[model samples]
Target: MVHTRERSLLPTEEPLSLLRKDGSPVEDSPLTMPDDDVLLELHRRMVVGRRFDTQATALTKQGRLAVYPSSRGQEACEVGSVLAMRAEDWLFPTYRDSVALVTRGVDPAETLTLLQGGWHLGYDPYEHRVGPQCTPLATNTLHAVGFAHAARLKGEDTAALVLLGDGATSEGDTHEALNFAGVWRAPVVFLVQNNGYAISVPLSKQNAAPTLAHKGVGYGVPSVLVDGNDVAAVYAVVREALESGGPTLVEALTYRIEAHTNADDATRYRTSDEVAAWLDRDPVDRIEAYLTSRGLLDPARRSAVAAEAEEFAASVRDKMNVDRTYDPAALFEHVYATPTRHLREQAAALAEELA
Candidate 1:
């Protein structure tokens, strides 16, 4: 049977943007622009998130972390996505989005636990309303939709904001989740960080749509595209989606400048020149330029921010350096409300062997 291929009927629209590579505004400031303080905070958080990624990569080299995924080039996308949510809103992050979790108030050390080979998830998902950093592709998209649906039924004013990569958009679960969300009008915002590559597979190989945002129209969900490297643009797009009380998708056109993870080598598939061009559009540099132009950031403030981030990195290092001895039984603790007979027997056997 020949299946008719789905294609984007409409040409891709121009993505919304507030800032450019030079940090200049794309248009005049709003009546109430993001205050100098909010802009500074956003800049500070992005810098710290970059430092966290670097420190985690270093830990893997030292054999401290089992694996590390550097969110180097996509900081603006992750940071902006999370910061756009309200404190009470929910976040569902992918394994590649430790920066988003950190931006949403997850402790950096705890956020890295799953990546460090620790037992179960690293932090209390309830406390932060941040779901586990999903390793299995597109699985948590379902969870995010369900949670938002439940919140609507409960008459709660919360939205679930979930993040995924361009590659994850290929997964069947992603399609199903978005379909259900559209039908139910679930209060969920899906952030697709279209970083060009789903691991080593480029978007051209995996996607045929004009833009990832176009995927939503089929599901009766609206979508917007953004310059993912622009913090202002990402945050603004996400901010609206989360507040609208219906499913929305934001496709951020960005690039993953690092290997998929510590274990993957990107050099084999991508050219040095391509990576170099992205380096020129680094989000951290762009934000700094904008802040400087507005006179919100100066040399002293820059040094102070660097020092603060360094201190945060040092603390994460110190915490990770301490040896952690997990109780084998804890693995059996959270899988279910009560342990199954088979699990109980296995847990007892492992305990006996250890004893």
Candidate 2:
């Protein structure tokens, strides 16, 4: 059974930072913001992620990839959170979190291969320490909790960061994971990208709670809501929470600003005016403005960054077209570390049927 409780507050109100919207700083945000170099890096990653998402969507439309969930406006939350992790840390990502995987050093080629259904798994989990993108919604949260629990038992200081959407918070697995993490004091960070929609369901319809971060209080996990469009805020919150060494939930309140996936048409549920309002507060634009105001970005450098991102996207597109075929017999390889007799018989039957 899951243990549910009320959400608790951080020691300070500074956790929820809404700074630097529309190219300017708000009067009341965390005083210590990121340095110029760090800000530039955030913008760079955001650009790269956006470019990758565009390319992936195009590939999916071309029938080269099976599916894609674009992180168009949500780049900051993913890149910033992933950037806060140490090299030794583990990341649990959802299908929409390819940007996080990319930032965590997963190869784009392998990621595309996994998305295209060419491989059951992408990169070797041991090598990259990045697990396969969990497509089954909030179920991966439990895996993150369990992994952290095991690591704690083994006396490892490593942490696990799990990324999911706002819609996922409504799932039973999410609640169970939170309860487990809180009870055991697991070193897990739950990063909820509240993009305002869980496919067709709006956030209002997903949960009646005022905020997802508040839900963490009941689980004894400290939680905060941040302007998800602001990469700096995301990095700061995640970095601090990871250092605190217990489960924390960051509800990044941002909008999708794009379709749920290539298969989804968000216009059916949301209005164009809503999408336009979010576009006005675009994460990429905010960073660009900040960089420009500080003289860290100029027209020439901006053009170069865009060109480089495009080149990277083009390379991924070319790589996705390359043949990376696998043997039909290998389909049964990783189902179990040691295949059971039942599985073996089923594999043989399937192989004979195909033949």
Candidate 3:
């Protein structure tokens, strides 16, 4: 009963899933799996990404980080989407997407700098091809669309990917960005990690669309709904979207296993039974199970991955545990291309105060 013409714009009837909860492959999916080596690498990165997420959370408790939004259960979406991007492509991540930043080769400690209350951005966006870890919802989508359009104008093949939450879908900026991208055919991809709740506001209140992907149809963008916890499925769908030569919207059905951040209590809004249900479908465990079942991950390999993750976590801890010192005047230096007289006066006064 599906219409052929609109099929390209609508998401699949069900969230596209390649692997079941038990680690068995779904037969006859049109999506193709990456090479075995790539799959193994995905598993390794997911392990390390999860560890970095946990370590960052621990640092928050120890008073090293001012706050951290844990992406613990969402590693598959975080790692899978980043790995799908080419080196030339740019990524626009939300504040909660530190794991994606890490997967994109950003230093773990640097990625947490903003959350640590130290810097506006922890790393150089130009060098890493990543925007600031955006805190304002849906604003990055517009930035991504503009960047992609500019790249196209310059005759570059570069594209952009922007990650968002379900709540962002309701923002005016998100609507504008999608409309612009669709009209211009900008080489941008919108990845909405629908992690059930957007900081305690369950998606039932944020969106009415059958799936977040369906929102794309109204804007003339092709849409895909995928099981966000399935790393391979996320990788494949995002890769296809990037290669589709136009803006596409992908809705990944995942769950945020942790509280919204160090500041929020999840128990007040959701039940432990709900959390327990998702824990059984844990993304990291599913990938590990599949790999082990295929003999690609034996005890030795598994142990090595765990050890590497632990070492990575230790490195982040060592780097973050130190006192962070900053010069007050340095902030004024980057604020403007040409400092205003008022700014200069304030900077001089601050310098005098410090002296």
Candidate 4:
């Protein structure tokens, strides 16, 4: 009985992976492959997603975006997780997950608005079922848990997927959120994209766990670890978790091939060789190779996908380039339902200055 009780709480012995680095299948893997239609869609989205991430990063250099955390090598994790969810499910993403946001159908321009120094969310949360891209570490997990628990109380079948980094597992809020999700068995999935760094700090310094997925067991949540570069594996794992009807924590072992963000210099801490090794494991290339090997993709299909991605990048570039006027007074409007005396005074002072 004790063994039975603990059976579901432990994570897989190894990080589940469907494909090898050479785009070959893993022998005797535990998970089955997704259907051909699903795999083809994953490949196309990954192509667009990589182009989107590259375009966003370039925007940071061009001063169109204040900053961007490139998800260059982690497209599989971003696209797979989003594609696994149902239309009604909610996604809580970190500031690094702009690719995931785009995969969820949010307008690329609206997705970058927060990084463009805008105070308000560019898109409506209700319409997209996505929260604002959270910059603060691990806080979104708490929100995800609360929303999932509330949905359960209302007898809604909606589930929530919250993305996190390896460093966020050390945050207090993540611990609390996992604990509550476990006890309540809320329909929420916590995806930890362990990209191996928390702003120049390596996982060696940030965590000492056997693996991040093991952190979930302590909170009574089932855990699974997957090779983050394998799109089929990621989609399969996340889709299962969302359909499992209980809280789950999934740790995807990916890497940050680029610097932490446009503002940080990664070379100061990481060696050139380290970055090169991860670049060879590029997620987009892996899926494209796999699809071609299976005859699921040909040169014509590949060229068509590239063309579509270029179109997407062009749209984002055009939208981001258009200049827009801003009103300074709009900042104070959302701070309070009714402005206090001090707030009124500040607004008046700003108004006088503008005049």
**What tens-digit string does per-residue lDDT give for candidate 4 at 223-313?**
9889999999999889888888889999999999888989889999999998899888888888888888999899999999999999999
Of candidate 1, the 10-residue stretch with the lowest lDDT total is 1-10
Instruction: Give TM per candidate.
Output: 0.94, 0.93, 0.95, 0.96
Off by over 4 Å in 3: 1-7, 340-355
Candidate 2 lDDT score at position 280: 88
Which residue pairs does candidate 1 place in steric collision? none
* Candidate 4 clash pair list: none
Model 3: weakest 10-residue lDDT segment is: 1-10
lDDT string, candidate 3, 243-350, tens digits: 777999999999999999999999999999999999999988888888888899999999999999999999998999888688766778677889999999998999
Model 3: residue 9 alpha-carbon error in angstroms: 0.5
Residue 75 in candidate 2, Cα distance off native in Å: 0.3
| Of candidates 4 and 2, the better by lDDT | 4
Q: Rank the candidates by TM-score, best first.
A: 4, 3, 1, 2
On TM-score, the leading prediction is 4
Deviation from native of the Cα of residue 297 in model 3, angstroms: 0.7
Position 66, candidate 3: lDDT: 90
TM-score between model 2 and native: 0.93
lDDT of each: 0.87, 0.84, 0.90, 0.90
